[model samples]
Target: MGVHPKESTAQNIENIKRQIGEIAAIYDWDMEVNTTDPEFYKWTQWIFVQMFKKGLAYEKQMPINWCPSCKTGLANEEVVNGKCERCGADVTKKNLRQWMLKITENTDRLLGDLDKLDWPEKFKKMQAEWIGKNHGAEVDFKLEDRDEAITVYTTRPDTLHAATFMVLAPQHKLAAELATDETYHCPKKTMVYTPSLIWKFI
Candidate 1:
């Protein structure tokens, strides 16, 4: 048996057509009929293609914390404490290939246009900070065998020593790979498994 629900082929197609028709319809109290036609879907698809062509949409392998009960991946922010938001099951980290959109690519233009728009000052400031417009150097740290390196962008290189040890996010490539090894698999062995420098710093 499949882990998910199953429907007959006829039922599935009928359901799809029903949903499409319902979505395309607009109801008015005056009984006037309005509908979102296939043209809307075509336009949406065209815009998506434009985004992809501009490199704003791309696919990459990314680890997501998955909640089996929900049968969906949860964003790191979605987990409360250590449990899934939907089912209260303890969330587990899962690695999978997923799509990533370059939201940061439009950061500067969005931030610049914010001032021209009549919005709340607090909201504007929040948007500006979210864009993270900064004059800084991007330093990369690489592993011995890996050609790729982790980049850290910072304005103050002098405070590097104060950093103690790098705190790699659990979702980071390095952190996830290390987590798979027996030496680092034990959560209770947090200090025991972490590098001596990081352990001391933590």
Candidate 2:
């Protein structure tokens, strides 16, 4: 919040922030660690620059509901019935380049330290689920007819003998890469197997 005065941060955004601050002061909700503090922001900028140099911060294409009229990306909620709520422009899928932080690099440590935090069991479980710190192995299964073998990550490697068929999520990266025709997503990861199912666990 403090450091990111990126080109994206406009005067209107700052105005809204100031307005929020003014309104909060009336209710005595003074935020201690203010983003407006230059002393705090400089350190943030330094840290971000260091992270960028270390390859921890990088850019990737992210699909989103885009509003061409607004010239800005709209959140799913901001799209009303396939149109932008603000300008009523038809929402479209766009692969916008976005800066992403490598939070997965710290996943192991975060998952391990979850028990040390003072939180309810349910909330801790939710955090763990979101972190996706699963104890699993990737088993490489070779296809019978084709030379290419798809890699599947599974928690139940013990059930390999019982596996009859595999199911792949329509949105899996491999789905598009391996598909001969047009394709598409699901929350839970899955495996898809064809008649060429041949197991070679690695």
| Top lDDT hit | 2
Candidate 2 RMSD to the correct structure: 7.8
Distance (Å) between predicted and true CA of 14, model 2? 11
lDDT string, candidate 2, 56-170, tens digits: 9999876667777898888889988778899887766566688888978889998989989999999999999999876788987776567776778989899888877565544
Clashing pairs in 2: 167-191
Q: Candidate 1: lDDT of 93?
A: 66
> How far off is residue 19 in model 1, in Å?
21
Which is the leading candidate under TM-score? 1
Candidate lDDT scores, in order, read 0.66, 0.68
* Residue lDDT tens for model 1, 100-147: 778788877888799798989998888888777777788776654657
Backbone clashes counted, model 2: 1
| Runs of candidate 2 exceeding 4 Å displacement | 1-30, 36-40, 120-122, 135-202
